[model samples]
Target chain A: QQQVKQSPQSLIVQKGGISIINCAYENTAFDYFPWYQQFPGKGPALLIAIRPDVSEKKEGRFTISFNKSAKQFSLHIMDSQPGDSATYFCAAESGGSNYKLTFGKGTLLTVNP
Target chain B: EAEVAQSPRYKITEKSQAVAFWCDPISGHATLYWYRQILGQGPELLVQFQDESVVDDSQLPKDRFSAERLKGVDSTLKIQPAELGDSAMYLCASSQELGQPQHFGDGTRLSIL
Candidate 1:
């Protein structure tokens, strides 16, 4: 059913610019939202996450903005760098469901030098 | 830093051949998960385990795929009579417990000829 939907399958941003990726979910029961970054030939790494109880959460250069009522969330990377270029995925989990993650399609981000 | 470990970073096998992948979650983690990621897509959960006991395997293809965490620490995933469509990256992740942040391994890239 594609419970999670992500936009802009790919993106390009100049160095020092802000990179944004958006995602939406269909399941209202989802309470946990997390973002992951993956390099080619590697598994994903946890980036930042936010719960429905908060509107936003930031860790260093990464930020996650979540809207509980709209069932949508977004990831923002400030001062993006070439090293930050990678595939980003958004995932959701409901505590009631044993915390099994449902992931988005993913967005390929390219940061220009 | 503790990290999940996976073996056989890459594997190439012909169709109908049997293949297996292994994972070792971070020490002290109590929850483990296996995921399959196709090219350009986010990972999908194949199975989840809590202390050597399966908590979820509904998405697993039981007819050909199997996974086990016999010691509540290391785990193995097997695919018998692999098909070309089975080509994908197998990732293993672990968390301290259900509803906690997950840490992933580098993953095993499987290519079925």
Candidate 2:
């Protein structure tokens, strides 16, 4: 079973529009959630993250909304720009040993100019 | 900015050939990881290391794949008698702490013919 499930394999948004991606995870032991952004021919880089203790976390234009009880989380991009176009992956990790991230399938976001 | 470094950004090899990839984690990072990502799929953990000691290799294909991190810094992954099914991206990541956000390298794109 996929530990984390992500929706809308691909998305397109006009510049300055709101772009959203959703993800759901199965393991409750996961306390840390991170979103990664990847471009073609590149490895993923951490975009933003949130803990279950917080309902939301925002860094600049990126935001992560988390729901502990539902075991779900989502990423929102405000005033999305063309530069925001890339593959976004949601991941989870429990405390300790750095077991490597349990990642989502990834969503390809395209921001129109 | 400090970043993880990986060698042989791209490799093309015939089936049953031996291939190797290398990674150098960021300085002062204590935890390291190897991941395999297939097309249209999420990255899967191949191995995890805490300093110079392996913490997990359960998902690794021991019959043909091997990995090591000597001196608690650089690492290498070797695949002997590679199969066509092995065509995928090999990614390396490191974290400053056990549960911290990981930083990734650009990854080695392996194409096993």
Highest TM-score against the true fold, candidate: 1
Against the unseen true structure, what C-alpha lDDT does each candidate score? 0.96, 0.93
TM-score of each: 0.98, 0.98
User: Which tens-of-lDDT digit does each residue in A2-79 have in candidate 2?
Assistant: 989998899999999999999999989898999999999999999999989999999999999999999999999999
lDDT of 1 by residue, B13-111 (tens): 999999999999999999999999999899999999999999999999999999999989999999998999999999999999998999999999999
CAPRI category for model 2: medium
What is the interface RMSD, in angstroms, for predicted model 1? Answer: 0.6
**Candidate 2 residue-wise lDDT at B62:** 98
Interface DockQ of each model = 0.94, 0.77
Across residues B42-94, which tens digit of lDDT does each residue of candidate 2 receive? Answer: 78899999999998998999999999998999999999989999999999999
Candidate 1, pairs of clashing residues: none
Indicate the residue-level lDDT of A68 in model 1: 84
Q: Number of clashes in every candidate structure? A: 0, 0
